[model samples]
Target: MLGSIPDLLRLLAVPVFGWAAYRDIETRRVPNRTWAPLAVLGVVLLLWDTYAVVTGPTSGRLFFVQVAISLGFVAPLAYGFWLIGGFGGADAKAFMLVAVLFPAYPTYYLQTTALPLEPSLVGVFSLTILSNTVLAGVVYPLGVAAGNLVRGRFSWAMFLGKPVAVERLPEEYGRLLEDADGFTRSGLDLDALRMYLQWRGASLSELRAAPDAHRNPDSLPADPNPPGDGSVVTDGGVPASGSPDQFGTAGTADPWGAERFLDDVEGSAYGTDPETLRAGLELLADADEVWVSPGIPFLVPMFVGLVAALVYGDVLYALLSALGLA
Candidate 1:
């Protein structure tokens, strides 16, 4: 089971790529010095797969075929993203790298064939996808939660050294917030809200240029309701949605929305999506939050289904029929 049939390289991609991201995030620079070695390593692996799985023997051909199959599956989705401006070049490249490596992992049953794909090869791929999706979901909210702590409870748990929203006040507004009690019984004036929105808009713009812009000092504001706590509560005053956040976070807000609270941020108003709103609110309740890119959550089903389909072509076909996609 170990003879050159895929083991080391397949598993190495995640850690290698993850470490690179972590380092880049820390340094704000993914130097060519670091990427050079990774590029060489990737090339070597491609050649290894080509020789061992493409030209060595029957199973080898199957391996190469699996790689092709999985890549084929993502073509449509990739195209869709390309058209929608959802992914930058790097995003597409990262996904392609994953595809070239993982290919078809789970071995499917073909000879026996009692019931179509009675055993799906959806184990490893599915688990990985599920875990990734959950992680992304949690991390975004945690960022917003950290923001909430600052905006409501005065905590600095989410500071990443990135730019914080700079209020574009009329030369004197910053002095006002310095008084410790900026928005008390006086009721937050429209000017302040306008300033907040403008700054928020600028922040969103900066974020699009560099997704990691708000890495440091993330904070959400408290709700602007009469009580003015950074909490989203129902009529009874119970916490409305899960609170405490660092920050899903994608939708444009370049245009600012109708009321800019619970609306679309489409090139404006933080691209309106309730889930995005929930995350943004958790970050800064009173201010606007918008997404820079438009990447949807990475669905595990995409990977797992592709692997199973390639390994056991018939099984994949049956799956499609069951879902009526065929």
Candidate 2:
């Protein structure tokens, strides 16, 4: 019964992750608060599981070792991915939570068969989930390539992005292929634009209506909805400002509101910098169309990976085994 408690508790993560995945798709942001309760619960349950294993028979010591390995491997792996820009802060947090919540595989039986059709050889359940996430993530790029092929658009960039009219760009999610300097892989993030618009309580139509009116900071008026005690909610659902300190001394008079937005948000957080925003805005003003990469909402694949890991264990391991490589 004690063992079953942890297994059952782990199931709660499914719905939480599902909700997070939905939010990631809709807004591309998940609140930090979303993970707070889960973090607390995960720690408490981990401690309880630790006590159960330690006090139980010596044979159960292997579970303890598996937990240690899962923590040691997954924590650093998740952190490393975040450090290198391979993973978002939320993605890293989710992976770490998985490490804490289910460091060892949770057994589930269905009639005559045991679940987790293939278990991780290293006994690291978190690692299995990570592998499954990567495998699931590959499908998006392939679909993009296929779509581009059907449209008769053949280019290396087709796999990364699709061309959209500049007028429709503001409504779209993703980054621009053209920057201040010209075409580049590291495009300007649309989220920054959304954040700027939200901070100023302005709309894209207003920007398009009077492009010159909001172009120069010196000519711009005082912010109608300046960042203060209240937080500005961006299109992505991330708070534009939690505190005044985040904006530094960026004047609110800037018509583009680019200065304050860029000042407060980190480059890594949005995959854009001040120069990129400035240049991208210029491109928007001049260009008729631009290439935009609709980045995959990673949480979707992550949720899929979690479900796969729970059912199939390590998908990559199974594939390699079938290929006779493992």
Most TM-score-accurate candidate: 2
Best by lDDT: 2
Q: Which digits, one per residue and each the tens of the lDDT, describe model 1 over residues 1-326?
A: 12233434454544555554554333222344543454555556667767765565476655555555556654344555756755433434445555544454434233554212333344223223323433444455456557556666342322221113432221111111111222221222222333333333333234334434332223222232222212111232222222323332224432222233332222222123433332332333344321111112233223333333333434533456699986
Local distance difference test, candidate 2: 0.74
Give candidate 1's error at residue 176 in angstroms: 21
- As a whole number from 0 to 100, the lDDT of residue 148 in candidate 2 is 87
Q: What is the lDDT of candidate 1?
A: 0.37
Query: lDDT (CA) for every model shown?
Result: 0.37, 0.74
RMSD of each: 16.6, 5.4
TM-score of 1: 0.37
Q: lDDT per residue, candidate 2, 1-326, as tens digits?
A: 23378787888899999999998887777899999988998899889888887787666767878788778888888989999998888899998998888788887878767767799777778878888999999988889888989999876578888888976765677888766566678777776666566555555556667777557554333433432222223343423322223222234544454665555543332666666766777777767778788899889999999999988789999899999999
* lDDT value, residue 162 of candidate 2: 85
